[model samples]
Target: MSDYKLGLDYALDQDRKDELKSYRNQFHIPKDKQGDAWIYMTGNSLGLQPKQTKAYVNQELNDWANLGVEGHFEAKNPWLAYHEFLTESMAKVVGAKPIEVVVMNTLTANLHFMMVSFYKPTKTRYKILIESDAFPSDKYAVESQLRHHGFDDKEGVVLWKPRPGEELLNYDDLETILETQGDEIALIMIGGVNYYTGQYFDLKRITQLGHKQGCNVGFDCAHGAGNVALNLHDSGADFAVWCTYKYLNSGPGSLAGCFVHERHAYRKDLNRFTGWWSHNKQTRFNMRGEFDQLPGAEGWQLSNPPILSMAAIKASLDLFNEVGMDKLINKSKKLTGYFEYLLKQLGEDTIRIITPKRSEERGCQLSIQVKNADKSLHNKLTEVGIISDWREPDVIRCAPVPLYNSFEDVYRLVEKLKGILK
Candidate 1:
């Protein structure tokens, strides 16, 4: 299939030819007791640490130890303005303007903060819409918002579900939901990439559809951010939120990124939850002055962020800046395509891929359904040092992350799956 050969030699040859091969060396791949690197395919869950992350994080630790209070203004990166250093590169990764992006609170926190400003409910338009299979955290966040606004969570939530027996969602189904309940919906919050199916939605199309129906649109891009070129600004969504730990390669529980479209940058009339960090930097220290909101996405900040976490983010963004999303995405397509090619060779009856076959409609992840298999298959994979994620009922999710995972890794993964199934 597609001229792909089944052998370790072919995987090695492809790795040798890969332009981004050097990037793999930059990460600290986990090793077994025998000193072999585990075939890690869970970058969608948590990325491996970059080698330079230690030095980056240590810099802040040393600055704090040596400089204390003065480190806020005198550290090498300057804690007071540390987040600004990340703005440009992070913006490039997500395809947003520098003014529209800010690295702030964690994913769910940022989502709640964004909802404060975006989820305005009226008596006539009080419902919210989300995918039926959205990540649990997002569903919780939306449901809580409904309860907070004095609406019955169950009655106020509308699900854009897949057709009967379908694993993937159809845009037409989403359109049908909007056409019938559009007037009653106040917000449309959906995941940019559906986690279980690995289906990447067209953000711009969803935005346009929701806008036509007079509903505010936003996206939880946790699975899409660095794995796919979100083109968030071009998508015209009101707001977006994503964690940096997954594809961004920041450490676990690291600060998340938020995007407020350029159009909303200067809308002072929009209600927001803010604190001292949201005050204009020019007069922020002038304690006697009245509240003056900073323009752009920075206006959403509630407090000064942890410099250590920001350092890790900076370390990761620096790499993204050098490699650029264009080159990374190119390699991702080839790598994931090869994975699909190899899996298909295993036979359609043995396995089924829920992710879209078209490259444009998905990212690095492939959700494979092993026929009549259970978690024991996944457990055996782990026993053999193949680190992957298993979703409930069925489906093993694997991501051939372009930053560090190799073609050989993909090869060995299939080989392991073959053995386990046999």
Candidate 2:
């Protein structure tokens, strides 16, 4: 990584040597009016569509057209057990056992559902803890959960904030908060990778800390799945939820994934809201049978999933299974390291990266804090051909997604950013 040189030829050379270089052709890269590809750096927000997604979706459509209701059992993938098809591949993506993972519901809905089983509150231990600047939606969900349980939302919530003027969170700060307020906290919910700062937290450390306090722990891995090695099973969290739209490359508003540790899989004593889909598959068709909840994460499903959306996920996951996380993460470090190298060359006085400098502490996204710059700077980048996310006031969140983004793409992005900064 230190050998990265500043020139177009260097980028071309890196791309040529990249083992995963051919993956870029699998996606449908966006183009301008002149047919030039945009420097897309917003996979943190929404990933580019896979070229194979259309064919996968079309297969489901064709099955639906021919089989109709019978497609539930007769279709090639079979809608009756369709979500089951996604369980194994997705578990691999998140580093969990096949029994612990399930694909169902959208992101926030899955978060809410996971809360139903994990967020057990009482008169004294009623507090819920989260990061200070959690994604706005997660903040809203936790606050609403507090209100729903008849506690004062403000008093029931605890925020683990960063030190003054600092952007990234320190684990020491999190530990300090738990030490002081551990007794009062019933649940600890945090973003696996902070959306704004792109800080990938230590899931295992947080889970161990929460468990030591007798608090249930969970993660909203909306930004971690398919982007980083979450190792959810090893983290030993009570539960987790993540969307497939971002790094997983499922379409917008696609179904999300949920994980329940194997220890809790057969624990029928745990309280949860259930539906017919949560019942045992053998008795699912028989209305007379009482609710015998299916074991593991599948026990959380409420209804049969959408086949088309699952098909898109299947398409992306098939590719993931082929390449594996080890290979993707290896290339990701080099591409992102090269990007950070180029950004630093712009000068620390001008460009300030708020994300952690260490590769293990972050995924591909870098939150660049451009001094004195505003939204217009982002607009200018967009006008030229860069697709990135602009947070309120100052940060530009750029993710050089390893699956589709090339070393040349990262080089061009930094070059364009340099022009804008100048």
Candidate 3:
């Protein structure tokens, strides 16, 4: 509604005014056969690679070629401390303290590792709670945890479901669930932003509510990490995990991040799986001393990290550190707001936006429900060089990442949809 117009000129004018417009040049936007750039809107899935990523990765390759074993300590960045290079910038991107964050493992692997420490369920309080529509990987991880703990997976899982016919979750319903069965639930693991609806939950509220009921709370922030202001430390959640391949733009299946609140930084009593990398660095080469677990989130590490993968992460984090989340989020709100405005102009009867209307309650992605449409609609969109993601029955998830996407990309997307629907 901010006096948005339905024309290419308006989008071009907005792009011209965008300070982040220069960033689009940093990425190599995919091109179709005719050499035109495809309107890439799936940053929420796998982010586009930064043009600098190859050079960053090549530096590690060259260091490895020049120095084999000595590269561990002699390389420019030093392989022995590669993960440390990303800690500060990664912490800043997620609004966490340096002691609270570490980059290691894939998303699901970090979830299980975190669960080994956090999901300590007594027989009386063995049930786990999660959104009914959580990503399949998370559901599988939680269910496996229940089975490993000698509990009935089916009976031990409690779902915070949306009301009949609705897509978004209701907080009141979650309160009612906790009020009645809070003591029986040992862990409340939820996606920070529901991937299907693009609805960002109030992490602090959920944490406080779960704590009042004597339950441990954590989040799978795969969808919320770089796209929204998570402020994981301020939320006081027990732990959180997310992948770097999404908004972090660190390539596919790159290292994921784990956040262990400062309160749990030094707790030796926590039951966690550990490996050689978790030992004190100074004594690590001794290979003969007692196991001294490092303090803070790094204590959870199980293996030496891959420098090539960490190189991609370092490349992406450098950009994030330069831009800062405050400015990125400011542009995200406006870009997504513009996408929503254009979709609303398509008429409610023709399509519906399942993502929360308030900019603060969602991120860059908008989940659109086209009336009576099937996956063929998504197929049609793809056929025309628009790259958007399609959820099972009908939702087309489009994310106009402020770092690379432009207002004109969004404008062209709507025009393509209109033509197909007509």
Candidate 4:
């Protein structure tokens, strides 16, 4: 691959040689009213729709129309085991065993479910720890969980914060928190990827540290799911939850995925909120039967999932399976490296990347903190059709997804920033 450390030409050349270049056509790239491409750099916010999504979704629609109640079994994809259709491929995407991964409720909802099971707090160890900049949903979920568990949030929800004047979080700070509050902390749940900064934390390290403190550990991998190799199985975290909308490219607000380590699978004695869907499949139809929880992550399901939504997830996972995450992440390293190089060439005095400079610590997203501009500049960029997202306060978050975004897109985005600055 030719390295594009300078301008658009190098980016163009890299795209020419890209093995995954042809797959871009499989997505429904958004277009302006004039039918031009919308410069979609917000894959970190929402991944583009796979062209196959419509067909996949339509398959279920047709089954529903034709089979009626029979669609639960007689259809091509049986609704009874619909979520099962996604397990193998999705297991690959998030690096979990088929037994541990299940696509069910939305992200925040799944986080609450996982917390209910794993965050079993005693009187002394009732505290929970999270990053100060976690997504608002995560913050609220943990706070509510503490209150639900009869712990005062003020006394129970601990913040693992960055040092003053720092943008990126340091692992040392986490260590300090665990050291100081280890005895009191019952759970440690951090975002695998920081939503705004695009920083990918070391899940394995975090898990080990939390376990060292005898705290149950978990992660919200909403940003890390398809963007990085989570290896949740190896990380040994108690549980994890993630969404498919972003790097997973399943569609906006699609169903979320949850992982409950196999270690916890056979523990039927553990507490959980269950329903018909979580019961043994064979006996599920036997009304008035006692709840016999299914094994592994599938046991966590409380209700029948939306088949249409599962179809969309199946479509995206199929694409991920074909290209493979290993190959995709390799390209991501090179592509994001090129973006970082070009941004630095523009000089750090006027702009700075809040995301970590180390390639291993992030995915394709680059959070640029502008020198003096605010949302007005974001509006200007939007006017010119540079479609990146602006988070609160400062930082324009742009993600060049290697799956659908070409190196040329990153080049164009950088050029637009240069033009606006000039």
Candidate 5:
């Protein structure tokens, strides 16, 4: 808000009025040498652990040790239906129905599996369209998909890039690309929220554009899920995938989530790599019946998941379900806006924010481009106990997570940044 005031008292007052302020106490924030909490601004990279995570994980360990094979059906939360427990809560986080959402493989693996079903290519329509600055893993995965299908990786990839000297991607540029080459594009896959720029794309608009041109559409929402309102079901994309490690606050290398629009939930004809987990629950152990694929996003599974990892995910999802995205996002806008407001006061010529200005156009991240700055500036931020991420060149990515970051955290960050710049 433009009315945001200056100084420490203003920040303290904001935190006092914050309805979600108590949530900060629920997480285990990292500490410096003196045991004081670090100013953690990297939730976009890896989220802080919740205090309840240990208890959640230990319960599963106890079940495994006590019940062994019978834990599948007899445990407190049955291993047989472990992933099912996460489905409804996670669906609410990403705006999908329970049947449309499933916690599955890692980000890129799920992307590859979704591609197998949605990236059908013909001789004339063999190209895939992606944002020019998509996360490196997404670029590599899509390129591998092209080569796997016998197309030249370089030629089969069409990039919807930002204009020269521009940081944010424009819809007009994307429209032009589709108009000129839409007929030859087989799939349109883009990051729901870009990693570097923190620009949250209009998923429904992009999906409509792709579908209008007879192209299959999907999104890698690794950066969007739990950070914003994705509305995946309403977007009408064929599929989407996201990881739990970032804004979801699941542990590092936790299981990822996948979404298949309800329309495609029962499409048995869709090609996918499968294992026993993808078979019908009733006939899965029969060992003599025909292949019976499970319906919905669960149909993409290739193996039974690791219980420890799922336990961690369940711990995080429970918090998400309790707090809800609405409350988190409401706090996020005010927190990030205050950050932006303070950053601008450092002199616009000193640092430039590459992320979108509109709250709806971006998440909590604010990518700051410091003039004449290098990695040393980032190192300085780290030395001062401000945990943030630095991209190559000049941008320093900071996400003041609404879940645990206080308004005081944002104030202290900008104050520290102001000193570093001086």
Candidate 6:
């Protein structure tokens, strides 16, 4: 295969012949000082916005301006329960039933809400199990949860880490931890795709292990939601939370989505933080007696959401609806695989791909472990208008989003990196 040439020109030729080339024009690709479109490869952090976003948002803005308070019902796309509009498409993207998913709140907030209900710790089993390399927010959230429940995080929090001298996490370690601390472990919450290493854990296997040990299971799918296929329903996780700003192509800090296994759909006895929005819609205005909670994920809402953010989410989700997630993901596997192939050409000693080689283990983002490189190298790439991201001390992350990125874009990125390295 190395004998065959796969270079920038070859990839661009592929782009020239692509069926989805037209979709690239639909997005507002960011530009540089010279007014050239910057190769945006950081969709793992923040996605590019669709040009139609303005029009979709404008429709709601116009409705709000004219209809005033009456816009709740009178508007073209009524504001009363505007979030419901994005549910079906969002569900389809993540492989969930319409009733099992809801788009609301930010990612971290949804995590806390899900934990409150699902992380039911008994006297004997009160520990929270997570990956050693979980995102900072997740580490903070679980630590705080342990404190809230009168447990010391130092003792109650268990991190399933890889064995000494190994870069990748070992599932055997997780099994070993559960075997030893099963009684003390009340919850197993992991990042479906680790942000730093780009490792996508086996959700079904993890969930099964947690369930066998009598622990509630959930996933913080910030990196997994848009990139990989998270069949949340079949995985049998108690719940999962993800943001739209990344792969979902919703704007920054856009309203997040959550999943509640259909099995827990109507467990009225479950504890949850409730607000007026969580109340029954028909009887909400009455506000007379009992707190009637809406069933499933909607019941988790703490307030009526800011409509503008939801508008952005609706805009992006509508695009997903038009194209369908299956089609996008199928295209994604091929596009991202091509990216992986090119990066490996740089030679293993020069750079290492931390993301899994299998299409099943990753989405679009590839975490490149650049050897003997640091922040300065990242700055050089940025100076040239390549918009990839560097996390902490090393590892440059680049994601060629399927909705907007062309194969030519990935080809150009490799070419740029080669020039920079030279």
- For all candidates in order, the CA lDDT equals 0.95, 0.93, 0.95, 0.90, 0.94, 0.87
TM-score of each: 0.99, 0.99, 0.99, 0.98, 0.99, 0.97
Name the 10 consecutive residues with the lowest summed lDDT in model 6: 1-10
Give candidate 6's TM-score: 0.97
C-alpha positional error of residue 419 in candidate 2 after TM-score superposition, expressed in Å: 1.3
RMSD for all candidates, in order, please. Answer: 0.9, 0.8, 0.7, 1.2, 0.7, 1.6
lDDT per residue, candidate 1, 136-254, as tens digits? 99999999999999999999999999889889999999999999999999999999999999999999999999999999999999999899999999999999999999999899999
Model 5: per-residue lDDT, tens digit, 1-422?
67999999999999999999998999999999999889999999899999999998999999999999999999999998899999999999999999999998899999999999999999999999999999999999999999999999999999999999999999999899999999999999999999999999999999999999999999999999999999999999999999999999988888899999999988988888888899999989898898899998888888888888888888888889889999999989999999999999998889899999999999999999999999999999999999999998789999999999999999999999888887
Candidate 5 residue pairs in clash (backbone atoms < 3 Å): none
Question: Residue 196 CA error for candidate 6 (Å)?
Answer: 0.6
In the range 1-422, model 6's lDDT, one tens digit per residue, is: 22324866777776777666777888899999899999899989998898888988899899989989999999998888888988888888888888889988899999999999999988888999999889999999999999999999878889988778655788888889999988889899999999987888899999999999999999999998867789999999999999999987788878899999988888899999999988998999997869999888888887887888888888888777888777778878888888888888899989888888888887888889888999888899898888999998678998888888988788888888989888
On a 0 to 1 TM-score scale, where does candidate 1 land against the true structure? 0.99
Total backbone clashes of model 4?
Answer: 0
Tens digits of per-residue lDDT, candidate 4, 1-422, equal: 33455756777888999999998999988887888797898988899999999999999999999999899999999998999999999999989999999999999999999988989899999999999999999999999998897889877889888889998898998998899889999999999999988889999999999999999999999999889988999999999999999998888789999999989988898789998899999999988888899999999999999999899999999999999999999989888888888888789898899999888899889999999889988998887778999998988998889999888888887788889889
Give the C-alpha miss distance for residue 180 in model 3, angstroms.
0.5
The candidate, 1 or 2, that scores higher on lDDT is 1
Candidate 3 residue 363 Cα shift, in angstroms, is 0.2
